[model samples]
Target: MARVTKPLSQTEIKAAKPQDKEYTLRDGDGLYLRIKKNGTKLWLFDYYRPITKKRTNMGFGAFPEVSLADARRRREEARSLLARGIDPQEHLKEQHASALAEAANTFSAVAERWMALKKTKVTADHAFDIWRSLERDVLPLIGALPITAVKAQTVIAALQPVQSRGNLETLKRLIQRINEIMTYAVNSGLIDANPIAGVRQVFQQPKKKHMPSISPEQLPELMSVLTTASINLQTRRLIEWSLHTMARPGEAASARWAEIDYDAKLWRIPGDRMKAGREHIVPLTPQSLAILEFMQPISGHREFIFPGVKDPKVPMNSQTANMALKRMGFGGTLVAHGLRSLASTTLNEEGFDPDLIEAALAHIDKNEVRRAYNRATYLDRRRKMMEWWSEKITISS
Candidate 1:
């Protein structure tokens, strides 16, 4: 015998008083309003499990927040899932879990995970540079979007401004970095496809730009002007050190007194400071050692061999040598980096082993044919070559 259950009227529900114990008012179709002893009213749906045929309670929301019509709509939706052999309660749980996963899979979150793995492979300084570059150029535009939602067009739009500024080199690296992150996302099962795969084709390819430099023959004039230049003594010494050692401007600026070994006549720049991200052993020459001896009294107590004029605790300004060169009437003729070029030209012309000269400059020979020779730093053989280079600069006139 089936009993017909009448639908609950809004007025009847509104008039339903709260009892001392919890009780329910049915609106039929497995929908009901539960009134607790505490006088809180909540909407609940009861349903039989599709597989096990067991009953379970699922909460819709609370009333009067959820009106009478809203509960009916939710009951019909739940029943529709039942007809499809799906348990509505379990479906809601799955939806909840999926939402949590998607929220944690934003582009920035995934990029951070990728960087965590990448940090182990590169220098700490390099890792910091990569992250800062992303923060400045990549993150602001698309960082908030979910990794799954980052399409080729989304990446293309973000990189166009960097390209517009003619930062083709930056654009190139950003595209590669973004693609690496997408690959990481794919490998991590965050997304099915890498939408950022071919986004680089949208931008212009960067042409190789060389740093401005002077000829090797003009070394005497540069040295002469550098000697007489009104710049501070430390600035003059730093420029000569870079020229003598064939080290980069940044490397010379950050040189530490602790890195020098007087007995061994070596300056061992750590992997973090080297451009190739490997420890570089520069065999010190008489000229380079003399420069170190000259600076011993000035920066003896400081950490950096060439400490900043304004603050001795920090490394000297990397551009100090550039400004001194520029101010000394050598503007547009040479920059601090030009010393490596000048050294390379003269040493190669002097019949020095190309590999030894490249090693002196700490250059990673990218030519496929010469990559086999990349293993050794050539510490012993490099000593004589460095001495010759230092002598050349001192006696060029």
Candidate 2:
């Protein structure tokens, strides 16, 4: 008959003192507390492998860190595994490996990996905006958690700050970006499902405001300000160029000298630099050409047509033209982008063909087949229309 050792009491375990050499106090079965000479106590389970029949010891945790009741609970779990012909040490090894893999597949890790792939697909500025939104709103809250553990509610809670600030538009865009990343995670086998699916329904839709611009009646005044404002020559040229071509302020501010074709009378914006992700052809009006020619003497040495005043290597800040407009007492009454609206409104009122007007604006066709057709058919009319528009501005001024 085998002698059964009594289970250890909380008082007995706490009262036990370390001696000169390392010694162990057995509880029952294979559970024991090993007391070291340095007065440190460690909880361990001594077990035998069912397959190899070899003896092994597994450390649960240090005493006081892992209490007696918790140690016993772990010991019972190990015994249950042994009774099922499983080795506890091997099972623990598998669990550790799984935990390590989960840690490597955290939301932050997968998001960064997805972003690396995205940098190739989107423009540098677009990629930077996405990364900045994630860093500011999403990652700090739950980025360290495993991808599988992120729930839809967790994501909603993470965006509450942005929502509270009444930046519904930014919140909507941030959620869409998160969905893209989670979808990438699903496709990459890092997560089973996208947690951000249907998150748009969680927030109230934001009211859409048409970008502010001056009325047609204000165009003469605007043209007058651009012609005579006490602003930098480069800034005045950027504003005039944007208005003449109906290009976005950013496109005008970041224009490069290499994009111009002096003979073709075309300013060919590359696909990557364009918002539509397609190359845009701006038929340079005589006015547009004169503006570029004027800028050549001042900015010809730099790559950018509108290089920063402080740094020639970089393009001028996109907001510089807008700030100049604001400084000229047109802050709320007009904006740089309003130039496009102004052109669209004036051209429509002037009885120009709508298709010709849209083509001159470089507005992309929604239908792919139609867009391919229109791009080929509209170039000549677009050039004629742009020339007329420039003349109209010149005469109106």
Candidate 3:
């Protein structure tokens, strides 16, 4: 055993240096120093295992941040843990786990973390847009509340504004998103049950069916009016494109050049972005092809076929197309989406097979027999049907 000196005094401890090049003192009993290769000093602590007689090293922080008194107190606490057969490192791990769960307890905090995880799986733009919408609409009402405290009523309140506007689809989507977030919280051990689960009881409004299409007798006049409608060239292209393809506004809005195969006369939408999460191959008619050619000059160099006016990064806004339709005196008469109804109704009247019509619309069939047999094999027939619809509705520049 080495000759031991008395415990370090406060005055001496404050002035001590690790590299005087004259004295040697091993760090033990909470006294420590780090002698750098350049002779700079950093304080640390050292101890011996009580049972194994093996020495253990402990960091006591840098010199200025950690004073001698603070270091001694921390060392004493650590020694007490060793005496209780508990490693301070193991205790710290448990503390970290508990702190993480506590931090994730609130809706806002958990949502932020959930968005972070979602960023890895989705585009950054999509993640930011979705989280920001939740922050403004959903989070303001129940964000700071504990995930466990989020009741069905809270979710219903968040969706009331959208629901009141007859946006039941959007309401359903927002509610589903909240439920998904709550499910994630449960998975992370921050909540027990998903508050949004089976939350349909909260919605008293009866679900409304899609609007009826314009009567057949009004089709010729509607087409004539649409032809002379004073809208932008891009807006005209969108209207014509929608009518020609009978596709959803979202599908046409986000259509990309790479998705279009001019040779095969097909527009292939990827499964991930498609609402049904199934790849859709739209057989293009001459009219749809003509619109694509006309728009190519503007969008050929870019990624999105129908680029937004303000930002080339995104597709054209769905609102722009709807507003253009409304401006043509078609509000509540012929929506941008009403084209699907027009086509489906007209084709069914024309004696086309129901399976073929459903396949053209990419609407999932409910009947197992129809779904099992529907393979979209009538591309040529669809191409002809779309051409006839386009000829019926003419949009002048």
Candidate 4:
């Protein structure tokens, strides 16, 4: 028969002092308080492996940190694992690994992984902007929460401040971006469902405000000011190029020397750089060529035709033309993007083919079959239309 040892009492365990040698005070059922020679008290569980039937001791923790009662509770939990033929030590290790994995799949962690994938699919500047918006608006509120715990109401709460500040457009984009991230999480198997799905309905629709633009009748005056204004020469040329080509201000501002083919008479914007995610060919007119020629002496040494005034390494901000227009007493009446609207209105009134006009603007066709056909058919007409448009603007001025 096996000898039975008496269970230790709390008073007796506390009264026990560390001796010259290490010793253990056994609490019945494999729980023990180890007293080290250095005066440290540790709780341990002595058990046999269910598989190998080998003896092993598992640490519950230190005495004061994990009290006697807590140690006993842990011991009982380990014994229950043993009864089920599971190794207590292996079970504890699996639990620890599961906790670590859960920590790694936190909202911030998963978002970073999703962003890494997104950066590959967008322009560097666009990717940076998305990251900036998330860091400023979304990350602080719920980035640390578990990805699974994120809910539509939680996201709405996060965006409330932006909505309250009258940044409805920004709020809308943020919600869309959040939805994308959450969808990525779901597809990545981090979560079961997207918390941001249908969440946009919770917010008021953003007001539609078309960029303010001058009517065709008002163009000559605006063109006159642009020609005569004491703005930076680079800026003046940028405005002329924007008007002549009818390209977005950003497209014109970020134009690189390599993208321009003087021989081909085209500015070929790579698909990744274009808003439509396809290559855009802007047929260069004499007026557009003249602007590029004028830019040669000033900015020809640089990559961007309109490099920022303060930082030549960076492309000029698209807002430069808008701000210049505002300074020229056309604040609410004209914007940089208004140039496109102006061209669309004028060319349509001039009875130019709608297809040619759309091609000139690089607007993507909704019908896939028609778009593929149009891409091959409209270049010549667009080239002619662009030249005519440039001449009309010059004649108006």
Best by lDDT: 4
**For residues 307-334, could you state the per-residue lDDT of candidate 2 as single tens digits?**
9999989888878988999998888877
The global C-alpha lDDT for each of the candidates, from Candidate 1 onward, is 0.87, 0.88, 0.74, 0.88
Compose the digit string of candidate 4's lDDT tens values, residues 36-70: 99889999999899989999899999978998889
Query: Candidate 1 lDDT, tens digit per residue, 1-397?
Result: 9877788898988887889889998988899999988778899999899999988889999888998899899899999999999999889899998888889999999999999998877655457778989999999999989887899999998988999899888899999999999999999898898887878877899988787788887888888887777999999999989999888888888899999988898898888777777788888999898899999999988899999998899888878999998999978878899888999999999999998887788777788555555545467778888888889998973
Q: What lDDT does candidate 1 reach at residue 131? A: 97
Question: Relative to the unseen true structure, what is the C-alpha lDDT of residue 393 in candidate 4, on a scale of 0 to 100?
Answer: 91
Candidate with maximal TM-score:
4
Score candidate 2 by lDDT.
Answer: 0.88
Off by over 4 Å in 4: 1-5, 14-23, 35-40, 46-57, 76-91
TM-score of each: 0.87, 0.80, 0.67, 0.88
Which pairs of residues collide in candidate 2? none
* Poorest lDDT segment (10 consecutive residues) of candidate 3: 18-27
CA shift at 367, candidate 3, in angstroms? 6.2
Ranking under TM-score, best-scoring first? 4, 1, 2, 3
Writing each residue's lDDT as its tens digit, candidate 3 over 134-191 gives 8767888889877767888877777788768776666676676787788898898776
**Cα error, candidate 2, residue 356 (Å):** 3.1
Per-prediction count of colliding residue pairs? Answer: 0, 0, 1, 0
